[model samples]
Target: MSDLTGSTDINTANLPIIDYSRIEAFFFEKTAENVAENAKLLRAVNDVGFIYLKNHGITDEKMKQLFDYAKEFFSWPVSEKEKIESCESKFFHGWFSPERTSKTRIADQKEAFDIGDDSNLVRPNQWPADWPEFRTEMNYFFEKCHEIHLVLLGTFAETQGLPKDHFDSFVNEKDHFFRLLHYPATTPDSIGDRLRASPHTDYGTLTLLFNDNSGGLQIRGKDGQWLEVPPIPGYAIINIGDLLSRWFNGSLKSTEHRVVEPPPEWSKLDVEGRLPPRYALAWFGNPNRNAWIEPLSSCITAESPQRFEGVWAGKHVADRIAKLHKDGKAPEVWKDSMYREERPQQQQQQQHAQLPALA
Candidate 1:
C-alpha cells in the first residue's frame, strides 16, 4: 500500500475518464461490450482512487442550477448565512464558515453548507428558511445523485464477487450528506501555507463530486505525488472513502486529496488580484447509522487478514466529523442519539434507563 501522508506538487497526472453509460448498461445486464468499461472503473479506482465519470445521467443544465444556487447562498451576507450555521445543529447539518472547518492545523479557506437525509430523525436537515426554491432544487439534485450512487454500489458489489445487493441493506436508510462548497477568491500571501481544502480522506462509503471548471482539486497517487484533477464539464469525479476501504479490507483505496490554488496558467484574477472563486457539490454516500461496518468475509484471507475491528457506521463517521470543529468535540446530544436502535416500547425504556449521562 502507498503511504497516505504527503505534500502536493504541481505535476498533473493524466487520470482516466470512464464513460458511465457503458457501466450503467453493465449494471443492468452482463453484456460483453460493457464489461470492459466496468473493468476500467475497477482498475482506475484501485490504482489511482479517483476517476472522472461522464454520461452519468445528471444533465449539465441541472449541474449549472446547483452551482447557481450555491453561489447565491454563499453570496448572502455573513449574518444571513450564519442563521443556519453548523454550530446550531448537533448533527453538523448547516452552513460552515471557512473558519469552522479544517483537516489540519491550518484552517481551510472555503465555506460549505451541508444537507443530510431529510428523513433522518436524529439530524433533520437545516434549510434556509426563506429560500423555498433552494430547498426544492437541492432535494431534487440530491435524489438524482442518489440514483447514481446506487448504480455504483451495485457495480462495486458485483465486481468484488459479492451479491449485487450486498450493500443494499446497509444503505437502505439513506444516511448520506450533500454539501455545497465555495472557495472564495484570495491572494497567495493571504492564504500562505493554507489550502482551499486541506489534505484528507473522506469518511463515508464513496463521494460523487461535481465542480465548476475553476480548477483546484488534486489526488495523491500511489507514487506519493499530488496529481491535478481537472474538472470536465458534465463529469462527476468519483472516489472511494475510508469506510468502503475498511469494508473491503484495503482492496479499494481511500486516497488523500485536497483543493489548492489553481495553476498559474488557469488562474484568473479579479480586480483585487485574487484568484477566481471556485464552487463544487459533493454527495457523500454512507451506510445506515445502525449498519455494522466490518470487512466482508470475502475480503479477509490468509494473505490479508482483517485489518479493522467491527464498528458502528454512524459512530465512526460522527467521530471523524467531530474532529473537524474548532472545539474538537461533537455535541453531547450526539453521543446518545446516533446509535439508538428502534425497539419495543419497554425495551426502549430499558435501554434509555441504562444509558450514560451526557458530558
Candidate 2:
C-alpha cells in the first residue's frame, strides 16, 4: 500500500506496475494505507490506461496450463484449425485463422480463438476435435478472470465511495469474452504497413491480458510515444476500455494500443518451422446488454459536465465488434442471438401486440 506517487508520473517513461495484494485489504479493512492503495489504483487507471498488477493470486502453475493449451491449439495445422472456424458456430466462438480476419487493414499473419458467454445472448461454443480438455481448462480460466474482474470492480466502487457492489448488477454469468491469440513471426523485412493488430482502442469496459512473454504489445502514451510493455513474470497487463472511459467522462482514458511486428529475439524458439509465434490471452469484461452506461455523477462537475450519452453495454460492444471484425458478421448463429438484425416489421408489430397494455 505504500504510495508510488513518483512511479505514476508520465515522465517516468514506464507503465505503472502495481502490487494488487494490498488492494484487497482496502475492501475489508479500509485502513488509511489500504485507502491510499485504492487511490493509487484509481490514479493509475485514469492516467496510465495500462498497468501491470502483481500478486493478484494467479499462480505460475495455472498460467502454464493456460498457455500450454494455447500452444497445443495453435500447434495444429491451418487446415486442422479451420475445422472449428468461427463460421461454423455463427456465434464467433471458434477459431479465426489469419485469412478469416478483418480487424486489420492489412492481412495479419496470425490466428485466434474467441470464446465467451454461451447463455441466451450468444450461441454455444465450438470445441476443437479431440481436445476435450480445452473446454474445461478455458472455462476455469474464464471464471478465474471474472473473479478478478469482480474484485477490481469492487475496489473501483470503494474508491468512488459507492456501495461495494455498485457494478454488480451490470455483470451476469454470460457477460464476458475471452480470446486466445497467436501471432506468427514474419521477418522484419517482410512486414509492410500491416500489423499483427492495428492501433485501436479496445471496445469493452476493461481488458485483462496474459502475455506469454513474446513482447510485441505497446501502449500509446499521453506523450504520444509507443512504450513497450515487456513481460513481468506473475502479472497480467490490464487496461481500461471505451465503455469504462466513457463512464468516467474520459477521465480514465482507453489508451490506444496495438501489437506490432514481432522482433528477431523471438525467433530463438522455433516450435513450428521458422515461424516464431507469440501468444496472449485476452479477457474482456462487459456489462449486461441492458445495463446503461453514463458518466458517473461523481465524475461530472460544473466545469466538466457529462461528456457522453448513456449507452447499453452489450449492444454497443456487439455493434463495435461487427464493424471491426473481418466479414463484419458473427457466425450465422448470431442471427438468432441478440446480435441478430432487427426483426421484420410484421413480426415486430405482432410481438409488440402480444405485450400487456400499459396502465
Q: CA lDDT of each candidate?
A: 0.77, 0.71
> Candidate 1's residue-wise lDDT over 1-359, tens digit each?
12121224457656677888898898677788799888888997778778888898888888888899999999999888777888534477899874645334566788899998776776688899878989988888788778888888888898767777889888888889899999988886666677788778888898999988888888877787887887777888899988888888878888888888877766777888888888999999998776778888888999999987666676667666765665332222222233434346534543444321111
Q: What 10-residue stretch in candidate 1 is worst by lDDT?
A: 328-337
Instruction: Mark the regions of model 1 whose C-alpha exceeds 4 Å error after superposition.
Output: 1-10, 100-105, 327-359
**Pairing residues by index, what is the TM-score of model 1?**
0.86
How many steric clashes between backbone atoms does each model show?
0, 3
lDDT of 2 at 144: 80
The residue-by-residue lDDT of candidate 2 on 158-269, one tens digit each, is: 6567997888877864567899998876655444555676677876678889988676677777778876666666788889888887877888878888776534453353
For residue 55, model 1's alpha carbon misses the true position, in angstroms, by 0.8
RMSD of each: 6.0, 6.3
Q: Which candidate's lDDT is highest?
A: 1
| Candidate 2 ranges beyond 4 A from true positions | 1-13, 87-89, 101-105, 118-122, 262-275, 327-359
